[model samples]
Target: MQETPFTLRAGHLLPYCMSDSNKTDFTNPSTFILLGIPGLEAAHIWISIPFCTMYAIAVLGNIAILFIVRREPSLHVPMYYFLCMLAVTDLVLCMSILPKMLSIFWFNSREIDFNACLTQMYFVHCVSVIESGIFLAMALDRYVAICDPLRHSIILTNPMVAKVILAVVLRGSMIVLPYPFLARQWPYCRTNIIPQSYCAHIAVVKLACADTRVNSYYGLFVLFGVLGLDAIFIAMTYIQILRVIFSLPTKDARLKTFGTCGSHLFVILAFYIPGLFFSLMYRFAQNVPLHFQVLFPNMYLFIPPMLNPIIYGMRTKQIRDRLLRLFTHKGP
Candidate 1:
């Protein structure tokens, strides 16, 4: 007897290929088959083009940001320190997914070791949690700079930023640490083929015959705890910053003050909006079209890392001047 190769379970489009043996109990497969994009397999090559381009930009841009920030002593401060954290987090986040995904698309390498898939799943969510915290940190930097300019330096010292980063890392790591462990315990007999291009927790755990609601619940908890709480705090910080900016005495003063934050706000929006959309789409929007489901998550992952360095390079005058000087080989 055979079961349907795929099904819509709680809005996930995972295809579970049943083994002919169809053992009723749990069995761990040595590897899982990664189908790049289930419904859009024909366009995998075309899709890889843009994904590869974005990955290249993410790598080069973030490395440049790190190099420029580190080389120029004048650029060393809480703001840039937090930015370095952001660069590192973005680098890790993109690397966790894009390389494997590209391999699937380009080389037709789809068989990922089960343990390796769990590792990917763990880092994918872990770094994402770290990214959200970095954004919150960035928002805090801007908030203090704008609202309490006189004490900004004192309030956000290098030591303080170090502590904050430590907290962010620890919290993100702790929150997501259980994911792979919990995933490992689940008994899988349903299918080894995950519909998504990458090894997401939901994509993998859904294959288990045992009840996976615990995994799902904990995933939700992490979403709200890290991304959700961090987002709320960021919004609140920006609101206070806006209040201070508008209170400035002159038109140029207002514009200039707000300009300092404009790029950050743009970056935050770029990071959060699509992410939240994808998160909700998967949780609630069951009947959403398949291509969109496949495409949007990849876009959400690919766009932010590529854009962050470009945004800071163009928008922050200090970084921009430094980049120009670095490129022109002009000594200040």
Candidate 2:
């Protein structure tokens, strides 16, 4: 007579390979596997090249922005200080996903060790929080400049701006740290497949062996906590800005103030709104093509960094003039 093998409720089977007499659940091997992008060999060759090129561009562009800010003394101010931090976050974000992401795309090896996968998750959330915080700080800078011009110098002093920058990064880190920790606690079965280009929080959360009700709550908290709070604060700041602008008697003054903030406002909306929509679409919409998931994250993560320099260059006469002078050796 054959003995029955015990089953683990989470779609996991106890050691069925061993001799029935010697088999024991206590010594059963449990290992996680990554079901990376489907249709492996074709995907590997077709997808990896473009993704790698993008990664290189993201890293190099942000680094160039950082260098320009550092070398140009005239660019030193609260706004550019915050801009530098934004670039730093982008650079870190690209670094977090790119190396392993390229490896996955090019090589047939889809095996990411538990620790490594978790580490990537940690960075994805951490830098996302940092980006939000930086945006909030930029909004605050605009608010101060517009609402209280006379006090702007006093309010945003050198030492003060430095301290605030530090606070923003630290605060963001503290808030996002919990998500990865909670995510890591869940026991993953062997078939832990993530369908995206990178280790997204939602993608990882879907792999929990235990009920993800708790994780869903945490995920909501993260969604609302980071994105929600920042959006509200930014909206309020801009509202105040609008009120201040309307109060200005001179057309020229209003135009100048609007010109100063226009680029930042556009950048913020470009970065946040599409991302929020994408998140909603992913969660609510069923049978979403894998490409949509793959495309949106890249748009939010990569596009903003690339757009920052371009937006600032086009809108700000200074950057445009400088570029022209460098290229054409002509006067603005």
Candidate 3:
């Protein structure tokens, strides 16, 4: 008996021998390799510098936001509480990907075990969904504050905020829990080389040897169900907010109301625009260059965490003042 040679075709290893049955046996791959950017392996060092800087800023900035919110008594409002939640999500989001990303870029460490890959995928998708939910919660907070200021405190009390946080975590976990489980059951007999720097759901699903239609559709379902609904509600809330703002008696009143939502709006746009673009590109633009496919998703993951704290600090007066006071205070 003679063994046929395996050929590399489109990143997958296919056996040259095919029987009359037209069937090929595929065993599960023990590990997967993450190919960091397709064409810029030579410049990975250069890429790591900015990525490292972004990671540092994201972690430290979110930590500062957390610290200031905790210490400042005046900052203990629903808005600040939501901001703190966003800060924590951003921190976890960045921490989930950046360390592994930096290792891939700097140390050329790309091989990940099957279970570890699934774990990373689970957290990445879970945290992203949670962040989207948080955005919706913040939008609702702004809506109540602007649309019905008299009842804002009564509606979004400390207990309510706690419940909302708990709900967000539960919803995100439940939706994202199936992704890894489905992927794990599928046998991966392909090249086991994920084209992106991280274990994204779509990226991992594409590597499975079995039919992935269910996985793909479920991903879309979660995408539309969670993020799409959140986006629609956020837009509706802003629409209501706009109506209220315009109905205000004075220009000062309208500006004040609009100003309260600036930070949340900035963060929302910063997060969703790129996120939608990357997702659409992954789904529709199959012919897009590998580097671009890898690049956009990385941007989607990296940009928000790095920018959220800055946007909140600059746009929210209380946060800005608290940050300044924390840095500038002289001890007695």
Candidate 4:
């Protein structure tokens, strides 16, 4: 069999060879080496500081959101329930890669088992798709509360919320399940080295020595299916929400109604805009630097998770008050 194809190492694109003795490294190797941010080896230590801090904040913030939602009986409603799900999804999404990633950065522990890489690939996208769905649910929750307050509780009962969560999980799983399987089917010839710290689906697929058109098309399918469909629904929801809010008689009432939605709007933009930008840049911007290619994806994955709970905590009065009380040792 032929040696491995061209590989990117430390910002240089160079052909790498694996002789007959190491040919098992062809097809499907036992391990894939993760080179954390090629060309930025020196800065890996510096990069790890903020990345580690963000991961810590993401974990703690999401956990706090979960804890507060579960503890406060008053938060046992649809919006807070959806918030809890979002926290769980964000928490899981960040956790799926960060620890292993930090290990790569700090200790040069870069080798991941072949199957383990696939598992990480599955989880990253799976939870991301679920996170998108949660945003949709949150948008719907706002729509019902503002436009049809009388039937809000009736429309989004506990069973309905539970079903929505189930649908989101199943939908995300089904959409993302093909990725790892497809990656596994392709014969990987001599290249088990990934450029990024984590198992990004496209990066993994590109490593396989096979026709990748089918994989690319399926990826596009998932991307448009998730972003396109969700964007349409969310846009419609907000348009209606805006119309109703504008129709309110008093300025104070209008301000109040839109005020409640401000946090969610910021969050929706925070989540989707960066996602869309990074995804487009990843696919189209080929001439960009290697370090950028590495940096942006990691930023895309962790930033929203870090920002989410902070946005909610700062903007939502009840959560802020509760957090203050928790710190100040005040009564409910």
Candidate 5:
């Protein structure tokens, strides 16, 4: 009988080791190799700078939006309420994912622990879901404002709006926490190398030894159930909004309605379309290069958060004016 001479390297830390059916003695590698962008050296050099700039702008922009909304009494309407909620979610998203991603890019070390990896993945998914739900709520707010203008205040009073936001946060949190749990439960039998900047669900699940049928189905259920339903609701809302806009007597009124929703519509499409496209690509487009997988998912994940404040500020006159005033006000 020959015994396997196992040696733990200086860099690799393993809490447990096992020999699988592949007849290969697999020990946890010291550093999970990140197969980064293949072609461009400039791409790698320029990537982190842009990411850091975006992160700073996103955090400050969103926090500024939040403070602007909080300080301005005129902006206390339901629309701004939803905007504030969106800003909060965006801030959370940046905080949750960016630091670790930046660390990976800067340190050249991607050896995250089982627990830490799962934690990052969990928050990323949870916040992603929450942000999506918030978008749905924003769409509904727009629907009410445009379609049922007379009852907008009554329908979306502070208390009711608070409850709706609470429900969205809670529901999103509940729906997505399970994904990380199920992901962490899987035993890694294959390569532990994740090719992306962050720990994504499908990426991690692909390394599992056990069957991932349950996780795959669960993810699809969530995708269709939460995001799909939100898409349907948004479509219906916009359809009715368009209908109502067309029926308006004055061009000014119709334009005003478009102005109200145009920013949100842009943000929504910006976030979801790319996101759904990437998800589909992952499942079907196996031939796509690994670099694109890294790049596109990061865009899908972070760009929305970065762009939301800019979109809203540009579109909403009150917000724009307030931002200018806040910045310009140096009175002691």
Candidate 6:
């Protein structure tokens, strides 16, 4: 067997005894550099303050929601069960990107191993897609609760909710798993500098020396097929919900119905608007400033996780009351 020219040293690949034949072998890059907030290097410190604050809030808020949901037997139903799932996904999503982001901003430590980058990309996209699916499921839950109140319990039983959560995890994993594989198959002879705080799919894919059309198309396919479909279904459910609300015999009933959906609507808008804008800007607005690109995508990742608990806490009376009581209660 012909001996390979590269050797591993301290987990870093180093060239050794390179010969003429091996020079053009297109050796895969062992590491990739992340460029965080390209034009705002001087402001990284100022930027990190807010980023750190948001991350802290996201972590604390999600943990609080998880704790409340787990401790309160009243929240054992399907709706809060799905909210617990959302909190978990948000926690994972924030943790996946924020640590690396803060590292880049504070320490300027941007070099990530090839496999680690791929792993981060997979989890980021997979959890995001799963969150979208959860939104759709929550919308359906609202639809049944308001539109068909008498059968809501029958439709969303414990077994059924469990199945839906399982399906969501499977679908998101299946859709996003191919992305890292496609990336791994490509050679990164070009510069391995990824122009974002984290290893976003498009940012990493565009670095490949090989043709990325298939990867690009498949990404857009998953984007539209999964997130797009979820959006459409959510909209449909809300439309039906509106019709039901407007047809209520009393004004109090209509207000009550609308109140139930307010939090979900706020969360859906918060998640999708930034997501859609970022997706479009990422694809079409190539000439947009680098700082805008970096800032907004990070916003897409951070804002939802931080705001979700706040929205729920303020909008949902039960959660709000529980939070108030928990804070106000004194130990004997």
What number of backbone clashes does candidate 5 have, counting pairs of residues 3 or more apart or in separate chains?
0
- TM-score-wise, the better of 3 and 5 is 3
Mark the regions of model 4 whose C-alpha exceeds 4 Å error after superposition.
1-25
Candidate 6 deviant stretches above 4 angstroms: 1-26, 330-332
Cα lDDT tens digits, model 5, 110-210, are: 56776676776677777777777888898899889888889989999999999999999899789878867887676665666565666666666776677
Q: Which residue segments of model 5 deviate by more than 4 Å? A: 1-43, 330-332
Q: Give each model a TM-score.
A: 0.92, 0.82, 0.91, 0.93, 0.87, 0.91
Residue 69 alpha-carbon offset, candidate 4, angstroms? 1.1
Q: For candidate 3, lDDT tens digit of each residue in 39-110?
A: 778889898888889889989989989988888889999888888988888888788788888898989998
Stronger candidate by lDDT (4 vs 6): 4
lDDT of each: 0.79, 0.67, 0.77, 0.80, 0.71, 0.79
Query: Which candidate leads the pack in TM-score?
Result: 4
Per-residue alpha-carbon lDDT of model 2 for 1-332, expressed as tens digits?
00000000121222222333323232112323343343343666666666666667767666756766675677788898898898888888778776766676666455576667667777777777778778899999999998998899899998999998899888867866776677677755433545555666666667666676775566566667667788899999999999999899999989998999999999888877776666666665666555544544554566676677767767867555565665786643
* TM-score of structure candidate 5: 0.87
lDDT of 5 at 297: 64
CA shift of 74, model 3, Å: 0.8
Give the per-residue Cα lDDT of candidate 3 at 72. Answer: 81
lDDT by residue for model 6 over 55-101, one digit each (tens)?
99999999999988887788888889899999999899888888988
Which lDDT tens digits does candidate 4 get at residues 155-241? 999999999999999998888889889989988874676778888778777877689778778777767777567867998999999
lDDT, residue 155, candidate 1: 94
* Model 4, C-alpha of 206: deviation from truth (Å): 0.6
RMSD of each: 4.6, 8.1, 7.0, 4.6, 8.0, 7.6
Q: CA lDDT of 76 in candidate 4?
A: 93
Q: Model 2: which ten-residue window has the lowest total lDDT?
A: 1-10
TM-score of 1: 0.92
